[model samples]
Target: MNKILEASLKGEVLVIKTEGYLNKDLGQDIQDAAQEHIANGINHVLIDLEQSNIVNSIGASIIIELIEQLQETDGTLAFCNLAPIIEKTFKIMGLTKYCSCYSNENDAIEAMS
Candidate 1:
């Protein structure tokens, strides 16, 4: 299934909700949305992945790029509601070194704050 990406501003943070597969198109869509917010100086991000189950390499690469960009401005990107398999995949790929994972949005938001 095609991915659906939605982004919204919650005070100083940007909350991104994604569903379906995280493939090339969806990954790029996420990158663009986050980059636009970053350019505008809104840095903290919370990605809700409750509806997403799979993330291909392309999606992972885009996420890495977003992390790099956020790092440049001392910003943080947190992810929440990830499937166990996806969380393990991220850990195995070493993405956990750069980003944080949370069990839910509230935890992520509190931490980002």
Candidate 2:
């Protein structure tokens, strides 16, 4: 499937919602997009994955990188609308230990506040 990475500025938090497959290549795009916002003074980021179904290893790597970067700046990275499979993958990979997971984008936004 085609990869889609659309980003928006929501309040003080930068919201990036990913659709399609999140593979190694697209993963980099996700990182780049998030970085663009952080460069513009957005420390809190929320990635809404409700529309995403498949995420490869490369995507997971980039997600980890985003979490690390956010942490260094005393920022936060939250995830929402994750598929059960992807959620299991993240938990197995220990992402949940570092990043926060929400049931939906609204909850994620509220947490960002």
Query: CA lDDT, every prediction?
Result: 0.86, 0.85
After the best TM-score superposition of candidate 1, give how far the Cα of residue 9 lies from its true spot, in angstroms: 1.1
Candidate 2 global CA lDDT score: 0.85
For candidate 1, the lDDT comes to 0.86
User: What TM-score should be assigned to candidate 2?
Assistant: 0.93
Q: Residue 3 in model 2: shift from native, Å?
A: 3.0
How many collisions per candidate? 0, 0
Question: Tens digit of lDDT per residue, candidate 1, span 8-95?
Answer: 8887889999988988888788888788889899989888999898888888778989998899899988899999988998899899
Off by over 4 Å in 1: none
> What number of backbone clashes does candidate 2 have, counting pairs of residues 3 or more apart or in separate chains?
0
- In candidate 2, position 61 carries an lDDT of 89
Tell me the tens digit of each residue's lDDT in model 2 across 16-92: 88778888877887888888888877899888887888888778988899899988899998889999999999999
Query: Measured by TM-score, how close is model 1 to the native structure?
Result: 0.94
TM-score of each: 0.94, 0.93
